[model samples]
Target chain A: MERQPVQRISKRALTLWRIYGGIQFSILLLISIGLVVATVLWEWPWWITAVAAALLLIDAVVFIWIVPGLRWKRWRYEVTEQDIDLQYGIFIITRTLVPMVRVQHVDTEQGPLLRKFKLSTISISTAATIHKIPALDEREAERLRQSISSLARVAEDDV
Target chain B: MYEPKRLHPISSVINFVKTLKDAALPLLLVFVLNGNIFSGDVDWIPLLIWIGVLFLVLISGVIRWLRFSYWMEEGELRIEYGFIFRKKRYIPVDRIQSLDFSEGIFHRPLNLVKVSVETAGSTGSQNAEAELTAIRREEAKELETLIFQEKSGYVSTGEEADDADIEAAQSPREKVYGMDMKDIVLMAITSGGAGVVLSGVIAFFSQIMDNLPIGKIYDEILDWIQIGVLVVAFTAFVVLLIAYAISIVLTIFRYANFAVYLEADDLIITRGWLEKKQMTIPINRIQGIRIDENLIRQPMGYASVTLISAGGSVLKNDEHQLRMLPMIKKNEIQKVLKMILSDYQMVDEFKQPPSRSKYRYMIRHSWLGFLAAVPVSIFFFPYGLLSISAGIFLVFLGGMAYRDAGWNAYDTQLTLRSRIIIKQTYLMKKHRVQAASGIQTLFQKRADLSSVKLTLTSGGGAAVAQCHYLEEKDVSHILNWYLSSRREEKPAES
Candidate 1:
């Protein structure tokens, strides 16, 4: 029951998250631009055009600048012989625990972007839910996976 | 050993009806396209197309019915089915968590039942491993008894499979509890879903009313109700009336013939109107018991009791397994629980957080309520002071939540008490807690308060319960308990 220090996910996750958010904003911006063009072609109301332009500006500022850093700071996890603890949420600050004995499977996934950065995401699955530790170093992810699996095995045997 | 036995021949007729109904939209689409191709000319193509599709559908249904067969072999239900590509399934009898029987409207008159076999492995809505359609009620009952009785080691082999054994197995059971008309009525009146169902009914009717384009009927009704506040009041009253009526009827239909029987180690619950559903959960499979008191029912001294069973799928809520005794009196809860679950003890002494916890709960609750009321009150003008009253009311409710929130640990069990309008006390095995977590936001970190979440496994899935805004030390104690101790075995009587 000795408390282990909660570890923050890699700082590089911030950049990754920002890039992902920017990509999402870009999609919204394109829709806004389309609306502007439609408004001009159809001679739409001035208020409608004003609202669309304002929304586009807000989206760019918030998604590109604010959210990722907040998210990166929020994402923290702790793994021990007993359980996996996660704390993350923007407004409500949700905390979750995944007991080792309940752990069914574990996988280290690396998408194209993550692979380029030498980062892997370790996903832990239980009977009811799945938990993830994103943007870990590849070797670290593998070592954690191994340790978790063995710990899970020991816990399962204990039960 | 694998001599397959087909389901009742009526299964073909059932499948035929099912397939034709399923094919309705496609047939209409084909007819429309055929009309388009011929430009409304008398080509007789649609009639030919309909006949062809009907013949194909009927043939497929018949083929599937003919192919589908299940047999008992080596303690497993081996099923071979499918029309073109043969599919086979083997389900070990012990792996089966529940065997549910539902008599559909058509099957009811024919004395047939649809048996849905569920295992611990399936989690989603389409989780039934195998569904046997159109079996005689007697055969279904016999199958149920054999699977359960043999499972309990009452019989070792299939050699004792005589007709009389099945009949003897069907002997009356001791009814532990049964729902009467009164209980159903109370449950219906206090239910929270009435408003939701009423809104749904209103929305559906409104959609149809909008489509009618019958001009003055709507206007005439609106005129009769008058404008302004009276309209709002009238509408609210009507909605409540309709909602309660619907709720009462739905509750009656759902709880009709509701009864629970204790048969050896299994607790069998059967209910439903047109579809009579039977669910069996072994006593040892239960993980936790929960008692809930609603804002409406609590004042009346009524509460509901439900179990967190490990492997049985509770069909009440898609996510929550509400194996709930709908309208049991709060005072009677302890007695009833003690008799049924055996080891159940209603904990009285609970440790409450300091009065400091009130600031967080009240402020957090009232702040949102105030903000929400602001817009409406400002827009409406004269009734603006009502927001102030609402804000105070919210704070009062929040105070109650803070006051009542408590936790207690004893022997091998832990109890958490919390209120979400409805007061709930969760009693779960302390050692059975699978996971634990604590959350502290920036402010809460400084305040030395954390919300602790404990995850426990139910029969079907993991159920999580949270104790919010407890002192930080308590959270650590809970986390520590998860690792440090060895649990004593439950008492023999249980």
Candidate 2:
């Protein structure tokens, strides 16, 4: 039997993800400060305290400067006859594949942050793990859901 | 046909009494702790309080005994229970995974048995989905037979028909495999005592440390001991390790009589020393099978088989699934696998995805443990250097663990192999997998990678057999295989 060629899907909303990174970086900065304060309260060495502070600064810089740029560069997905493929990476390129036949269920969720941005996250669950694609517009997420469900139903075998 | 019968009305009261008895040890410990804290002298008030609580509990037990009622109607098992807020649970006969009948030495003379019915639903409740505290042995057997017949898709014939089915089902007791005295001895000899002793030592030291003054005195003693303490501590650690090994061996010997047997379609594992336990796992609901060989077992040519099921709420220490076979010869693996999967071939080796450097990402990410450990360990331990050394060891192990994790797939079969100290390889078939998911974190997207995880439903729970950080192409290929199979037109057979 002839097998159909695999197709790729665009993982848009990379721009929105860059914004999320800034928020996360701010949270990390607060956490780093908390750690430093905890170390002082515990009467640990002052140098160790300095190290914690330095680490926090480094983390903050990565999130604000490097992370947004990296997010913009990475994030895309594709669909083929047999499976769904997602590829994203800034420095270290990584790809993940999910076979349609193995999909147990699919869900679409919108957080307050994403809702404000008019975006939704598409979640696909298999037996062992759950996968998600973040920051898609409602129309795009709906379309993806319908296509994936139809594909999953088509691939299901009578065992 | 054996018709369903109601349990004796007093069964619920008996169940409540059993629960109270089980709680006695903990309750006593709590009372002792409270007495110590209060430093009371000849406290009659505490004794009076205990008496009052016991009297209340006895009254509640009696009320429950009067309220509980259960009966089998058609193919459904109905249980009505509760004292103030009455609750009823209706279970379909087919949904019953196993109907276990157990009788303790005390109950044996009375001809009473405890019937525990395990179901697949996860209600997050410890109470057996359905339990009859005390029933006649014959009646329990009759109920078990009826449930089994219903699960097997056979029509129930009232009492007479049921008798015939029971006769057919009852295989010779001699044919069943059970632990003898010798087997228990061997198990004890092989199971080292190191784990038990180490846990005990840790617990003892932690208790001592908790009570000790942590201010200046503790620091002075720790500092004075630090120079020569590492060597002495190391020697003491080694001795404790040896003691642990011996204890494990003793424990295994005590439990050596362990044996598993096939009774019809059920797998029965019976073992224990002072307190004996017999657990049964039904074959049909078994989701996945795992074969494990520790360094000792591997050399001994023995392997343990665990069955991942959907219903077992309790997790075994050795493995997550129900241990169907504690110890069996390696050669017997294929035969046992065949019994589980009659039609499928046992694939020993299969093609795995080409190595991806993404593993390095996992290794790097694991250093985050050191991030948490460094601060906490330094504050808690007076021997800060030793704590730091332990943290380094953790980071090294974490990196190796990430690198050791790998996945392989062939046709409709996939196997995930991982190891740190103990090796575990999960084998699953495509049809057995209930779900598949692909995930991409913000960082993974930048790395051009996504993680894929596959799950299979087992007896009482689900087993995630394979997880990997794979290239997008490979992930798509696997996903396509799963999706394409779903499209194929075929008659459904369950």
Candidate 3:
């Protein structure tokens, strides 16, 4: 709708999402292994192990392989002096517009993992809602937070 | 007005009652846990502790009342409170939005009123802004006038100017709307309050059941199974009827003599029979208006209008007051709304979804019902076939929803109408929209269908207005409308 937001997030965000997905897939892998061990110990149906293996395969492909790339492809955002436009979501594309005048504040946050990846997430807050743009380059996130906040202050419109 | 003043002496009593109300549950627990007093096996220790706690609570209420003092100093309302912690709050007069006045039974006979300071700064806070439990009516009026004059940059010129200012302040407020007896009765009868009361009654009964010898009763009930079924069903019906009656009476009490008035820039709503309430909402603070028509009311051609305001404290204590025109004939909404908020116009025609979206709506609404029907049909067999009727009804409702769901952008205002159970139409100005979004799922993308949503700031949170399964172009049109307005505002700003 309205030609999705013009700017794309940092390219490394793709690798970051895949890494996050990999961690989740590894957790599921361990769980499936536990199920296989239980199947062996209890002499459970062989199909139980088969189901667990099939689940692990599906999770590995969907989460670690397919979803991250698609998500990275979908994520897009653009900030103008007047408004902030965001378009994201893989299967369900959502395009949002937040007028700069309504923005209350802006913040850039980076956790341990994000810090290691040199990525930061910037959140734009209005009086009633919060919009977050995740996995931007750390410097870009900082710049965006400062620019958005200054623009918000200059906008000076009250609810 | 500058002197640090205490509330009326009756405030101590009001404080005592308020504290006791909050402690009622724990006190009841203590009483119930203590051995049966009727059996003369009462435990003296818990009883003594209870009495001591009650006494302490009473004393603390008095101390709290005694310690509380409020004064206006250097363009701010300064409030000093707390018996031990000694809390102090200074609210700038500029941020003080409005003063809400209400009269409880305690305040009524004594010619006193409770004052709640509604401030712009109270957003996201659970507690309401500063409250004066009980104050003289005249003092409250004077306080309001002082705040008003200070806010408006007018200096009071002794007693004569003060009197004149109060008169100016009390100048005839145009009576915009009033609910008649018939409409109030109809609104109460059709309200969803009965369901809430019925649930409460069931909860209370469950609590009572927990203390009863249910196993014995169950065995006895089983022995009389056939007759017991009829008796239980009849009793349940009677309980429902009773709950419904109680809710109707309560609604009537709450909405008795409800009226709306327009004074300068504020819309004042006053209602209630037992405890009177008066709330003032600045016209500018209103973000949007939501008209709700539940299944019953819609069929009856009735609807309720609620103002989405930006004041957090306005949401506290009986938000029913915010329902500006609680119940009016659907057609009459425009007439009354014109008097209060002339900027909003009712758009009778809307861009309805394409005919192809009808089945989608039906599937969306009835999928869960139909899903449940499968298990019911399997478990109950022949009788369970009737469960299919519920799913059919939902499907029918879904078709109606598809027909009802529509969106219209008229000038600077956007109206989005949608329904699940309660049909709601939100009328919002372009400037008030905090965010707008267009959403398209994989299936909808293939079908060239999308949903459009807009968010408006309401009280401490946000209210979303959405119309689903619209043509993709229609969704884009709304997004463009929202975006274009921002561009339009830019030229004016420069």
Per-model lDDT:
0.74, 0.61, 0.87
Clashing pairs in 1: B309-B459, B310-B458, B310-B459, B311-B459
A1-159 per-residue lDDT for model 3 (tens digits): 457678888988878888888899889889988998998899999998888889888988998889988988899999999889999999898989998887887888998889989999998878778899999999999989888878885333246
What is the alpha-carbon lDDT of model 1 when measured against the actual structure?
Answer: 0.74
Error of 2 at B156 (Å): 4.4
Compare the candidates by lDDT and give the number of the best one: 3
Error of 1 at A19 (Å): 4.5
- Report the alpha-carbon TM-score of model 2 versus the true structure: 0.71
How well is each residue in B1-494 modelled by candidate 1, as lDDT tens digits?
23577788888888888888887767755665454445556448667878987988788878888999987777777888997789988887877766777776778888998887866552332343788887888777667776766665666465346777666666567687888888888888888878778788787567555656467655677665556458768876888798888888887887788888777666788888876877766666666788888888988988888877655444423322256577788888787677677666789898887788997888877998888888978887877858878889989988989988998877667788987677888887754565667777767777778887776666446777777888878877766665455424422433
lDDT (Cα, 0-100) at B241 in candidate 3: 99
Q: Model 2 chain A, poorest ten-residue lDDT window? A: A1-10
Off by over 4 Å in 3: A29-53, A153-157, B29-44, B122-128, B155-161, B217-222, B374-386, B489-494
How many backbone clashes does every candidate have? 4, 77, 0
List iRMS (one decimal) for every candidate: 5.1, 7.3, 3.1
TM-score of each: 0.78, 0.71, 0.93
Q: What docking grade does candidate 3 earn?
A: medium
- Give me the displacement of residue B192 in model 2, in angstroms: 6.3
TM-score between candidate 1 and the true structure: 0.78
Q: Mind listing the fnat for each candidate?
A: 0.35, 0.21, 0.69
